[model samples]
Target: MGIETYLVVTDLLCSREFPAEDGRSDLGIAGPGYHTAELATSRGTRVADASMREEVMERFHEEREALAGTLTEWWGEPSHMGLQTIRLRTATEEIPEPWARLSHLMGDVYVWEARQCGRWIVLGVADRDPTDEIQLLLTATETDPP
Candidate 1:
């Protein structure tokens, strides 16, 4: 995925027409959140060779930085929060919507919280399962859930 993924998702969010369906097309992705309460617009693209995990991770970081740059322009600086510890509890615990769901896949995430609007925007990369995909996902949720 590229920066366009971020742009498209942001457009979807701004329009309040989040991909309510689950599937992937070209660079567009929408699906159910790992936790049902949080509906994340997600996309998963498979790696051509699982052995290229290192290369994929390097690319994931590069893409993350690019997207983070755009996000900083829109949401201001973000807090780079660690999730390694949190990932431990995901299996035996129910932490938080996006966290609980994301923890299972990544060690950290970039979070931008627009507290005044009650929303949090998250960007993360996942390569935990080399056989699966090197994913870059943009997701959001309410700061205070109902």
Candidate 2:
């Protein structure tokens, strides 16, 4: 019903510990370095009130920052990628742009890579009004499966 935001992480051996409700079993398509886990949540569960849009956005920012901090602590600084880069890469691969339709709901989408550990982490936040529902996803993987 709503756009889902997926937080994807590649290459870190903790998939067994990920909760089952988070779609860890679905195991979406893997890219180059693929060993991953995913977690998802709906926007309604995040912001119950329509008037709290700003607060909800703030929370998203905090969550993203915390995730980045944790990853950095565990794996060190990350190589960052932007939406444009992702778009270009997808276009080059002839794959449909995953974020095209949900672009309006997105505030910031960050893709971070820890090459030394062969890991990739993606954090996408929905900054739209609370009335519009969205899904948040978190994933960890090794290489992109071809």
Candidate 3:
């Protein structure tokens, strides 16, 4: 299995525990969502408010809750080391503009929270073998008029 890579790209982080859908403590939530807008945070910086539409905020909350559920199921403990690879796939070729905006807002929130407080992450497996090509070649038929 190939390990997926995910780098933390946020300034502040949340360390407190939050309720997942199941009302569990093992599952925690963090986001740069409502924190500083500045790209980088060092010794001294101001935290900015996260911006989003009402509907978008609602969706973000739902997504965070769902994520919490998955986290609770996978790991009893929530920490960054647990997350090395995460999968993100969609039928859509590219994320819609609105969704992209929401993603940015949510991502920032989570990251900020994580930086402020410790965070937990989940790993994922990626397909790295040439099985697809091999299967395609194997399926080719050499016999004629069988």
Candidate 4:
């Protein structure tokens, strides 16, 4: 498959004002004293063979780093950044509704979190098959101090 990219943004300010029918604008349910926003994307690559995995991986990293740079410019350095594993399960699996649907693609996930502009921003990327591309998910949430 050729390289494909997707992005989703969720902001309470924008959503509460201008809601999206597809629900991409919604921050979903949040407890008292908290609000959230998010941006997610999928990056797919097209290669003639699996040997090109390295090249595809490089491109994925580039895209992710570029996104990080943008976040840094907008929010300053992240308070926390690291790699973590996220597992995905299939629909047949009795897991959360959201994750169940994503079970077809289960693997390691990378994440970054920061507090900026009065919100907590979370950036994540799910590990994909070396023969394929990657997916990125970003979220920003507002919370009141106790």
By the TM-score metric, which is better: model 1 or model 3?
1
Q: Which regions of candidate 1 deviate over 4 angstroms?
A: 14-51, 115-117, 143-146
Task: Using lDDT as the measure, name the better of candidate 2 and candidate 3.
Answer: 2
Q: Provide the lDDT at 7 for model 4.
A: 26
Better of 1 and 3 by lDDT: 1
The segments of candidate 4 whose C-alpha lies over 4 angstroms from its true place after superposition are: 1-48, 83-118, 129-133, 141-146
Q: What lDDT tens digits, residue by residue, belong to model 3 across residues 77-107?
A: 4332211112132234454222232232232
In order, what is each prediction's RMSD in angstroms?
5.4, 7.6, 21.1, 7.9
Error of 4 at 43 (Å): 7.4
Q: What number of backbone clashes does candidate 3 have, counting pairs of residues 3 or more apart or in separate chains?
A: 23
**TM-score winner among the candidates?**
1
Q: Report the lDDT tens digits of candidate 2 across residue range 1-146.
A: 11122223333333333342323245543333232323333445454765565565566566666666666675667654344444444545643223432234454555555565454555556555456644343434443311
Instruction: List where candidate 3 sits over 4 angstroms from the true fold.
Output: 1-52, 77-146
* TM-score against truth, every candidate: 0.69, 0.50, 0.22, 0.43
lDDT by residue (63-110, candidate 4, tens digit) is 656666665665567544332121222323344322322223323222
Off by over 4 Å in 2: 1-50, 84-93, 96-107, 115-117, 128-131, 134-136, 141-146
Question: Candidate 4: minimum summed lDDT over ten consecutive residues — where?
Answer: 82-91
Task: Indicate the worst ten consecutive residues by lDDT in candidate 3.
Answer: 132-141
Residue 129 in candidate 1, Cα distance off native in Å: 1.9
